[model samples]
Target: MATVARTSMLGRLGDMTLPIGILAIMAMMVLPLPVVLLDTFFVSNIVLSLLVLMVALHSYRPLDFSSFPSILLIATVLRLALNVASTRIVLSEGHSGSAAAGKVIQAFGEFVIAGNFLVGLLVFAILVIINLVVITKGAGRVSEVSARFTLDAMPGKQMAIDADLNAGLLTPEDAKVRRADVAAEADFYGAMDGASKFVKGDAIAGILILVINVLGGILIGTIQHGLSAGDAAQTYILLSIGDGLVAQIPSLLLSIATAVIVTRVSSSHDMADLIGKQMSLRRAWVPVAGVMALLGMVPGMPNVLFLLAAAGAGAMAYFSREDGDEAVEGEVMPGAAPQAGGAAAAPAGGDESSEGIVPEDVTDNAPISLQIGYGLIQMAGGENGALVSRITGIRKDLSKAMGFVVPGVRIRDDLSLPPNSYRIRIGHRIVGEDQVYPDRKLALPGGASVRKLRGIEVRDPSFGMDAIWILPQQVTEAESDDYVVVEPESVIATHLSQVVTSNAADLIGPDDVQALLDNLSKVTPTLVTSVVPKLVPLHTLTAVLRHLLAGRIPISDLRRILEGLAELSGRNLPPIEMAEALRPSLTPLLLQQLGSITQPLPLITLDPELEQILIRARQAGDLDGGLVVDNGLASTVITSISEAADKAAGEGRTPVIVVASPLRRSFAAFLRPHMPDAIVIGINELPDTRRVEVVAVIGGQAGIPAPNGAR
Candidate 1:
């Protein structure tokens, strides 16, 4: 029972350690401490400062020591409190002897300054200058800049996380973790910006306290003890210098630690490993060795010291080269034999050889891919790389608009392409290709340029608009001429975005369908369990979704789609028939995409007689070949619709084709080859809350009349 009570008491003390330390620091400022306790606190302060510096040195990244700001505040307070306790003791006891305060302070005065008060004062001043002027000021500036940049980059980082989530590269949990990290990074830098001010204030406080201690001690010694002026100065000044040094050394250490944390770059390696790897190159050491050797041979130089330094550098260079060669050989000769002429050869049919062989039947292609040539590889990755981030943003925007998660794009280099060209592919087939100058900006004329710019002219890859590639220096001139400026990476990302959106139906397969169902099951388990594999098979639902996606309809509202499926559960219908049956239920979603529901939908209508004729033709099996139309009539209809679409686009409204229920699908199929950008919707697909305005009528001229009973 006694042992158990002792264990419990120890656990409670561990929990209360921080509060106890804080209370003690506060007490030291108000209450007078004995010389023994004062000495103990000063020693502890030195140890704590050293511990903080060591931790900062070993941290791989700033975030690895995220609690540093709080620790900094605590250490600064502890040191100040110790200074107060030491000053009280020093002033009261200096008249007795140099050893009056404690052995710690006396040892610092007698040994560290070599019993010279002037030397101690100069050393203390230098320490104060180094800490306050150089390290503290620089650390404060870095903290301010880091905080500002971190805030500026938060939006971009957030968009990148959303992109990764939409591309299926990150799950919801992983995205949450990443977003938290971004927030934490901002908070840390902001705290560091404030914590640096504490170090600066502490340096100033140290200077003031030193002066106070010396002046107070002199007056007290002369007036109360009746000592001579010179004797008083000798006694008080020595104690003052020792007290200042003891406090300032720890202050200096904390300042250095603060500087180190604010300046460290986030990397995989710690400080020691990073410095060693970068400075251990043979090429770097060889020049140092040659320079040192040359200096050693100069006439008046210290011959022995310079020669010894040169020899050391040469030895380091030789060892670095040998290590590099051994590393290369190890990489090249894994399970390989040494051949003639010192070349390493792979062992035939060995495990290492087998690892290099890929099976011919393997088809490991990304659903979408972007391939850039060698000249643009630098734009794909680095601190300033915009291509990868731009592509990620594109994927996120397209996914939100299309109502489905787009697959991640795989980027690589293809040497067969031209140096400035890039290709976007879906599966194994190239869908779009373009050329962009990585070093120049593309300027497109909005209207007519104020003056013609001299540069290589090309068509915009995504929209085929006429544009000129101009030097970065010409951006001002081009913009002054009313040209819209675009970066090269933005152009490529835009083209890739278009290609992926147009082929969205092809990207979703059985696997993607099942993943979506699994996610839905987590929220509405009963609905998924009752509908899938019971009423409608999984493939049927996938096909229906694909049909909608092919027509550029968003399937993001999965619950609505499943509800529609459940309503028609008993009937065994074909996929196309099911999709047609489900169209009316999805009319609101489609209308929301066009614009606000309060506005009228701009539409082009088909003549009743012409619609009937197309319906008869489709019923008579004309879909397999083509719509039943002569060359002249087909040309006339195509021309009329194209003119109406251009007008609608000019008015900032999407062009939609409205037809009767039975004729909608067939008429859309007929118009697709001619007007790929037009949207075709059935009359029943229009919701009652929406209004319609007929912008134009197709197939209503050249002797084609409306049917008698047509509205």
Candidate 2:
């Protein structure tokens, strides 16, 4: 019933802006007619008229008329039906069959003066309205029913009331005239609605109305009276005028109730109050009824009566709602139904939806299961709110996995980052969320397309955009799509002038590093010095090299390099995913060196022959100044030789090394501390140097430089 009632209300309101306006204009138009005209046609009961009209509107609301004319026709016919019904009731209120026969003369006399004696007085009014509308139809387009209502029936032109223009029917001119009729109707009914005070979210108006009606009813009953026939008739006539105004009060209340009820009903809830018991109806309707009921009742305990009436009406509205298998789509409010997947049958193997994705979207696109490999970061934070602070959560996770007593190193998950730091993307592209897709196929609204940072194409949605997906687009280096640019807020960011560096040591090769860098100036590069800092037992550079070679670079020491980058650049560096990248290639060699720790010769370190290779490469027009670019093989070689030879010579030890190539200049620089007192150059790169006194040859357990065992 609540559903029905509410639906009924909605259906009416859906047409709300119009029909009531028509009724208002009609009533107002007839208002100035003398009492004879009112008594003759309108039939003297405004309250009943309103109530019947409202009920007709409520009933007609659900009818299947797609156009304005159909609605008007239905409403017009409904009004006539209501009129005839009211008349039958009016007639039945009087006497019996014999009295009717004797009253023929009186009936005739009454006809000459009053009019209809059959049925009810309301019937006459319905006929008049119906006749009027029928007559207006023939009046030609020059003057339509709405125009007559405007020009002859009433005044003022408001288009909002009867705007039937949007339905894609009817000419513009007809609609222009129709506006006034619609507005007048709306104003008449809207006035009552505005005065009803029901929809203001609480029932203060209903309470007030109940009070006023009861008191007013009693007061009017008190003020006017008579006992005799003619005198009583006159007294009643006088009271009827006041009754006319006060009678509409209940209709106003009825309007409030009807609207809320009908809406729910149309929504498939038969009653108006399906809003539920958890909510109170008195709170809704009391404003319109409470005070009025109190006013109508005697001043004694009117509040109590008001409360009872409100409670009763509210309860009726709540529980009397229509039930069903059918409900309107929009009526299904939130929290009224099970949440998505909440009640869904659990999938086989329990719920794997811990991440909460639609089952359809989850696929192989998700990341594979893998253990944490390694990570590093270059920059550091000097103070507060730097980029370093946001990492607290990650640190917590990592700290938990590795036990507490590892090295007393504080792995900060947080830093003092700036409020507006950028991820430094290729273009400032924004992908809304995690997608399994790579960007190239994801076209923008404006016909733009994105390409991957690398030429490698991906079709999965997961690989698409990220909040962190900005790259400062640099030129692609060779066949690879890898870009090299300055960091956004780092010291390097301002100088991001190139796509790749001539000397990028972060990528590869312990062995290659030695071969590539052997000829560099005696000036040391930070990579070797920082990792193998010269100290006593710790940094004897030998033990340190061994430790590092064995992959025992402590977290404390690793953090120093990270701190240096930060101190040098004053920027937020991301956790180095690149450091972990190194572990795979670097780990094996480190392990091998560690296993053979007992060899006194320290054969793991680079000899001068390898250093000579780097020097020749440098002198062979292959070096870019002191740096090597795009030479992974060369860079790796230089780095390895530099590290090995540096560690050996740190103890003031030297090796008689073979050399041929243009490396003499570079070797002089690399071995500056252990400046070899005597060198037996390798006979291979040397011309007949076998006859030379100091020939360096690698033989037996190890090679030694003999002083002229030749010649």
Candidate 3:
């Protein structure tokens, strides 16, 4: 009974916290506060303001501190209530001296202002000017503009979320989270715009309160207390200015905090680190050192101070250069490929390789790794590593699409690679290797431009489009010529994304599939328990999922996939056959990703005669695998399909090939090596709800035929 009572008592007290705080603030304004309590409250106010400022500086994004507006309002109201209470004390006790109001006010008057009322007043005025006219005003304006823009962009942001969801780049749960963040962001800025007025009003109220206290104190001291005019002026004026200073300093800090929050851009780093990294450029510091050294030599300058400043800047430059070098070189990890002839000589005994071996010596365990040459190292290291952030985003998006978390990419520098090259590996196999120029931009020429740009021509690594390696300064000129300019880091990141996405099947394993089942059990426990390892073994289920992924099918709807598997459990089919059987139910997912339901799906179809010939060839020769056709016929069919796919691509449409259901899987597999980009679907997989537009008919010389209407 005692323990229960104690728990109940704590919960009740927690519930009363807000109401109690409100009552205390109101009492501060209505009743007289003892000197000790007033001093404590004054100190508490300063501490609260500093705490707020620190939180604002450390917040990675505005939404990270979404309650700041409410907090700001409470702090402003508390400050105003303190002002009212202090004003009462100042007016009633001024004749007694500066210590009459509180020790905090007295300390500000004597210690801060050196017992000079004039200095205290001047300092308070400057603080008020800074808080009211500069920081508070600027923060309010920024809040207003940010709120307006955020609200204006809400529709577009929501549409983008929906588009990504439909495209399978975001799961429904991820879309919901993104939508909530967007709405919260809009509400935060809107609240911030209104809360800024409280800060402005607080600054104004401080100045007015100070003026009133000073005027009232002097009148009461001289007339009612019968003090001399100069004595009243000296004593009362000091007390009033000190009271204002104590309140105004905290108000200034809050104003600066408000400005920091309103003007802050969302970043992964804190304000201090972000600013430090951006300001640590060696080239920028070198110029500053040179200018400072030149000024130190001028005849009228303070040579000692100027030379010291020069030396400081020079030190910063040297350290910045050293930091850059360390960041680049230290990025190489333990798994990096060794340099030729640079391996340590064997010990007095035989080579260690002859005696024993470790796991790392035999194989890399990481699912995905990026190996960059020394010259391209800077793009993947240090505080502002663009490639790192981009790869993180890719993993997140791919995880949503693949229905499981994508493993993190490990980055390392390889000494054996050419200085300007990079290699992307999945497990132990290298998937992509390409060269890039860190100092240059890749400009892809669009067909709309007639003039050729002057630069070294190359093929785009991601898409194999004709591109030029142009100077960074020529970006604007290239854009004017209808060329798309891409950064080197973006080029590398895009290639990595493409490679990972294409080989997504290779990345998933039995363990990953088990993780998917574990997550599914939380929501649909019976389905997971009944289907996985009972109807289908874990490895077989993993193989089925890999086959779907190889066909560019998203497994995000794991519950639906499991339910489908349960219905087919009695057959005891192989993984490939099970996966093929599940495709009809999962076709909507693939179609929605290709295009929206509102637009007709662009399809490339083979001629009826050719389709029958391929199906017959597969049945006669290799019924279990791809169609086995004569070389001459295969060459002719591939050429015709390639031309049609290219034409549709030039017209900005994703071409989907429609084939008979019996030949769909084999034909798709056969075309995988030659036409990797082609998406082959069974005619039955085309839903009746979505319309289809026939873009081309391969292996025929006739005019275009009418598209099959809606399925």
lDDT-best of 1 and 2:
1
> Considering summed lDDT, which 10 consecutive residues are worst modelled in model 1?
327-336
lDDT assessment of candidate 2: 0.30
| Candidate 1 lDDT score relative to the true structure | 0.80
Alpha-carbon runs more than 4 Å astray in model 3: 1-4, 112-115, 168-174, 321-504, 507-525, 551-574, 580-671, 677-711
Where is model 2 poorest over a 10-residue stretch in terms of lDDT? 366-375
Question: Residue by residue across 423-442, what tens digits does model 3's lDDT show?
Answer: 99999999899999988999
Q: Superpose all Cα atoms of candidate 3 onto the true structure and report the RMSD in Å to 1 decimal.
A: 8.1
CA lDDT of 167 in candidate 3?
46
Q: What does candidate 1's lDDT look like per residue over 1-711, in tens digits?
A: 999999999999999999999999999999999989988988998999999999999999999999999999999999999889888888877899888888888877776577676787888889899999999999999999999999999999998788667755467888899899999999999999999999999999999998998889989999998888888888888788888888888989999999999999887788888888667767788888888888999999997788889899988888774322321111001112111111123346744535556673245466787777767766765456677777767776777777777877767665567889888888888888989999999998865576878899999876556799999999999999989899998999888886776678888877777877887888899999899988888988899888887766777778888999998877878777778888887766867878877777777888778777767777776644245766676777777877777667656788678888887777677786666556788998877777777777787453232232212
lDDT rank order: 3, 1, 2
Ranking by TM-score: 3, 1, 2
> Least lDDT summed over 10 consecutive residues: which range in candidate 3?
334-343
User: How much lDDT does each candidate structure score?
Assistant: 0.80, 0.30, 0.82
Cα RMSDs, all models: 8.8, 29.0, 8.1
**Native-structure RMSD, model 2:** 29.0
